[model samples]
Each structure stands twice: as structure tokens, then as C-alpha cells.
Target: MTDVRLAERPELPDRLPLPVVDNHCHLDIRRDDAPEVALRQVISEAASVGVDRLVQIGCDIGSARWTAAVVDEHPALLGGVAIHPNEVPRHEAAGDLDDVLDEIASLAQHPRIRVIGETGLDYYRTGPDGVAVQQESFRRHIALAKRLGLALQIHDRDAHDDVLRILVEEGAPERTVLHCYSGDMEMARECVRRGYYLSFAGTVTFRSAKDLRDALSVTPMEHLLVETDAPYLTPTPHRGRANAPYLVPHTVRAMAATLNTSVPQLCQALSDNSEHVYGPWS
Candidate 1:
């Protein structure tokens, strides 16, 4: 019964008018009790709903290793690797931060690894003493992305100002994306003005995310992106349920409605912008 419940997936929504990419997923992180969700099934389900491509982000060491090994096995998947900010202090305490980062750098060199992040400040969970080291990790990631010419995906939570300040200090990669962007109209404006991409997650579909919608409305189509952040931030109507890339349609429809644009239009923009940011998944 427990396995059955964990195996239950949200029913597939109507197919999208055009295909899009779920650009920031952590397929490597699964709940302890959840049944193993095969990568093939994840791809097929997502493709059936017109979310045909995905970019997996592996921010911690274990997931980073998983990403490097599995990314090439599936044509539908590309990947990003970095040390998550929340994990940085732990790595620092373990005295393996440098060694772990070295391993991440090596893994990032994989051709299928086209991104250098999901790395940035996460002030919500990380305490004050860890801030400096966390910021340093973020800077190192920024430099690594520039060095490799790969896209950079940031995971910022409750540290918008510091994240932006550090991005400016270190000079963000040419293709920098703020994954699961949670900032308001003002920060969105600044990010846009600085030529960064804002990737919306399921939270934008929530009723209380008027500020997120406002940010989305003003963001130019060229600079827009979308992600599931699966296994987290599942869209409304399906809130409290486990998220997967296939569930993207709910958020996409909400985004379309919020921007007052056609679903197909937004889907096309998402696809095109993803290619621009992470290159061909094939």
C-alpha cells in the first residue's frame, strides 16, 4: 500500500500546443520511501505532454556524480553540476569542500553537462557564519561557468540582494539563469536589465504569487524560461503532490493566463530560450 501510494503520479494533462523544456529538475533526489522512477518513464511522460526536453541540475556531490553518469544515457536530458549553497558549509565542515569542488569541475567537463550551477546563496536555511563560504562557492561556480562557456543556473532563496550583488562582483556567465525565480518586479527588472534569464517554477501559479506574476508580466519573452523544480514547488491544483516534469502544463497554462498570451506562444518562447541557454539536448 505504501509503495502503491508512492507510485501514484498525477494524471497527465492535455498535451501542450507546442513542446517546452523543464530546465531545472533534480531527478537524483528521491524520497526514501518513493519507488524508483525510471529515467525512461520520466522522459516519456514528459514528452507525451509536450515537455520533450529536460535539464537536470545536480548541485550536491552525490547528485553531481549521478548527473555526470546518467546525462549521456538519455538523449532527452542535459545536466548541470555544482555544490549547493546549503551543502557548502557542510562540505566546509567536512574539510572536503575543495576536493568536492574539484570533482564537480571535472564532472562539469562532460559534454552532456551544459550547465554550471543551481549554485547561489540560500540564506533561508544557511546561518550567518556560513554566508561567506557560501558566497565564495557561488563565486567559484560563476567563474567555472565562464571558463567552460556553459550556462549558469542559480538557486537563490531569501538572498536576492546578496545573490545579485555577488553576480555583479564575479560577472555572471553569458547565459545566466535564475532558476525558480522568486523575486518581485523590481528585482526582475534588475535581472532583465543585466541580461539574466528568469526561469519560473510552479510557485508562480499560486494565488499569493501576484508579485511573481508581476515579475513575469514585465519580463521580455526572450529572457523568459520555465522549470518544474520537481519534487518541489509543484503547481497549484496539484499542490502538496510530488512534482515531475510531466506536470509542467499546469504551470505553463497559469503562466500563459498571467501574461495574457497564448499557451503555444509561451511554450515556443520557453523552447527557444532553453536552446539558447543550454544548447541542444540532442
Candidate 2:
């Protein structure tokens, strides 16, 4: 497990005006003082703040297995399974990529496995040598998601053009999402035009993220979603602290301000868009 610690967890933001879902998060990543305790604490705190549901994403074999089982224990949680783009090269080197993918395919059949994702291209991390492997894995995942009739969550990082190209070339699944959407206004418009969802994370709240805010301003409420991607990208006012689903209210409120809409209106839209993408959480 990778160690993740922040000076302290942020205090909960004001309760949301309406319930919304955390469309993407990695709860299995160890964070906070005690992981198990922190996990429950985050869930409780999130519910108290009107973040009523979450989609836990597992990008590797172990976390994918953990997610499949964990969702069974929590009424408010669902799961997504895949091998992250950055991890594709490692699995390929080990010669176990195909086997692990088969396992993920099996895990996808679980009732609570509502998504197939946290997959896509990441040019920022993977080198030229690893790009082919990542692209190949991404195509396989796209096919898996289409076959299973599940939502597809993409992790695009510094590879927006290629990611979009590949999606078009392979025919994107009906419900594709750009998790922690980092593109500008033009890209955002293109994605929305294609019927894909753009999920904003706390990164949009940073002062340096004017482009992200601009994208949010142009995005229609119907195609927008919100996420924490917690234990990372903590919103301002809590940037240095550990992020959890409870802190989602901060990002939601920021997005509302950018969109010139009321928090309640945005929350309702987010909740609706989430259901539209992932289906009913129940």
C-alpha cells in the first residue's frame, strides 16, 4: 500500500443544499491516521454533509477485489474495476496483464460493479515506450465496458487528444466519463458534444485553475458531475490537508459559483447526472 498523509483532515464544509454523489474516489488507498477508522469516518462525515453516495474505484487486482467486497457492505457505495493506465506497463512487464484483466472481467459481473474504469491514457506518467501498452489496455477496457453495458470512467492526464482519438476510433461506450476533467473550454465543449460526462474534482477550486473554471462555466448542468478523487486534489482552504468525500461540498459550492447557479440547483443536477451515468445507487 502507498502511504498518504496530510497534516490533518479538513473540517467538514457546510452541509450541501441537496444530496449529490461522489462520482469518483479511491477509498481503498490508505490515508488518514488509521485507514479502516478513516474510511468509516469519511463515509459518515460525507453523509452528514449530504454527499449520500460514492463510487469507489479500484485500478488494480487487489483494490478491485477490495472494491467488489466493500460495496457489498455499504448501501451507499458502488464500485468500478480496471487496471489504471499508469499500471498497465508494469503488468505487461510481468506477463500477467492478460490474466489480471480476465480477473477484472470476472469481477465486473458483480452486482455492485456499476462501472468499468479509472482507465485511459496518461502521457504525463508513462513514457513513449509504455504508451502502446497503455493504449492497448485502454481499448480492451473500453470493449469490456461496452460488452457489460456499464459506465466507462476515463483517467486522462496530459493526453486529452490521444484519449479522445482512441475513444472515437473504438466507438466510446454510451456512458463515458472524464474523471477529474482537466481540459479547457474547447475540449469540454467537444466532450459534451459527444455525450460524454465531465466530472470536476477539487482541482477546479485552485487559483491556478482558471481554465478548468471556465470549462465548468460553459458546461451544461446535464453533462457535468462532481468528485473528490480524495486523499488528493483537496480544494482550497484545505489544500494541504487530507481530502475525503465530506470535503466534496467545497468543490460543489465552488462549481456552483462558477456556473452562476445556486448550490441546491447544482447539487440536484449533479445527483441527476450521476444517476444518469451510473444508474440508481440502490
Candidate 3:
């Protein structure tokens, strides 16, 4: 097992212990100055909290390759390959987007690279020059995921309609996941009705996330998933610090409360939902 430090100390409850899978994370973004050490720490901390598996996502070619290497080393971790919408312009201009996409496609052939994304639109950050590029890039990623018959993990930030429209228009892969789902109840219901998976991140644990809680309350247990989005959304007590997979249980507890279920039951449902969307846990 790897040795990693906890991003924050989580108070574990005794009665509701359950295995968890962090459906989304950026392991590649950790300190590259000592990647092995950092990764080891991440693994150790996650395992401590019953996080049996983690899907490590990469947003560009370098990050993708790095994440694949991590997956190669750790059997419990899986890799996700894609270019973030914000990075499209730089990649396209460098004439490396195709090469990157090709590499990602080839990487997906690996047993551990189980999903394709962190891909989708970010209209919240789009300028005129970036908007067209983002759309085209998002379309290409969608088409690639569809063609490869792989699970697609989407990141829609303040561009829900466009994101949903493109997915519907392009005939999104049968297995589609909205990572860190930030939509309201209507959108949640629509996603559930369409048989899509919604992954809740640490944001759902925040006291200010009443809308997210409302959405979670209405979402069917079978269609819901939970994640830390680690190295990012760290959940309540750990907020303002770098997030990690071990903190996922906090989000799980929050989701359980929202769903009016026990943590064990919620965790089981999340495990089933994750496996259904992304296949058997690595």
C-alpha cells in the first residue's frame, strides 16, 4: 500500500462504515516535484477511509500520460483521459489537439483507463474567441467517446443547456456521467429520466448548498453517485484546503441525509450506480 498524508482529518462515524469510490479526481495535478510520494500519500489516505477505487482524470496530453502511468502502478486507481474545454485553444493552436486526442483514444484501450472526460463546455469562462473553440472541441470529444463506445464524463460549468443539447444531439454514449453535478432539481430529474448518472462532489456538503441538497433529495438512489473531486472540493471541515479522496465519505453522508437514507444504504447505491456507469471497479 502507498503512504499518503490526509488533506484533513475526517471524523469517521462507527455505524455507517462503507466502501467508497471517488468517481472523479485529478491525481496528475498533485506536486510533480515528487509525484511518487504525492501519489503514495493520496492512495494511503483514500484507503484509510474505505475508498477502494479512484478515477484519476487528466485534462491534457501530459496529464493524461501521467495519470495512465499512475494507473499502471496502482491497481486500485483508474484513469480518465480528456482535454478540458479551457485548454482547447492552446492545444489546438499548438497543433497538438489531434495528437492528444489520438493518444487519449489509445490510452482508453488500457484496462485501467475506464472513462473519457472532464470534457465539456465552460461558458462561465468563455470569451468570444474561446466560445467557438470550446464548442468544437467539446463536440469532438463527445464524438470520440461515442465512437469508442466508452463511458463519457462531462464537466458542465454554467453551460447546462448547451452541454445537454450537445450530448442529446450527438447521441451521447449510453453511459454518460455528469461529474460534480451542479444543476438544480429539474435538471437532476431530467438526467435521471434519461438514465444518466449524477455524481455529487464536496460542494453538496457545504451549508450553503440548499439547491444541491434539494436536487439530491429528489434524485433516485439508483441514479446517484458521490465523489470528492479531490485536490479540489474538499467538503465541510476540509474546505479551503486541497481536497482528497478520503473526504468522499463526508459527501456520502450528506447525500444520505438528503435522500433520507442511512449511509450504508446510500453507499451501496452509489457503488451500484458507479459500476453501472463506469463498469466494474478497478
Tell me model 1's lDDT, rounded to 2 decimals.
Answer: 0.91
Clash pairs of candidate 3? Answer: 4-41
Q: List candidate 2 segments past 4 Å from native.
A: 1-5, 32-36
- How well is each residue in 186-276 modelled by candidate 1, as lDDT tens digits? 9999999999999999999999999999999999989999999998888987776678899999999999998899999999999999999
Candidate 3, residues 95-128, lDDT tens digits: the string is 8878877888888777778788989988777666
Stretches of candidate 3 above 4 Å error? 1-16, 31-37
TM values, all candidates: 0.96, 0.96, 0.91
Candidate 3's displacement at residue 140, Å, is 1.6
In the predicted model 2, the residue pairs found to clash are: none
Reference-based lDDT, residue 272, model 3: 76
- Model 1: what TM-score? 0.96
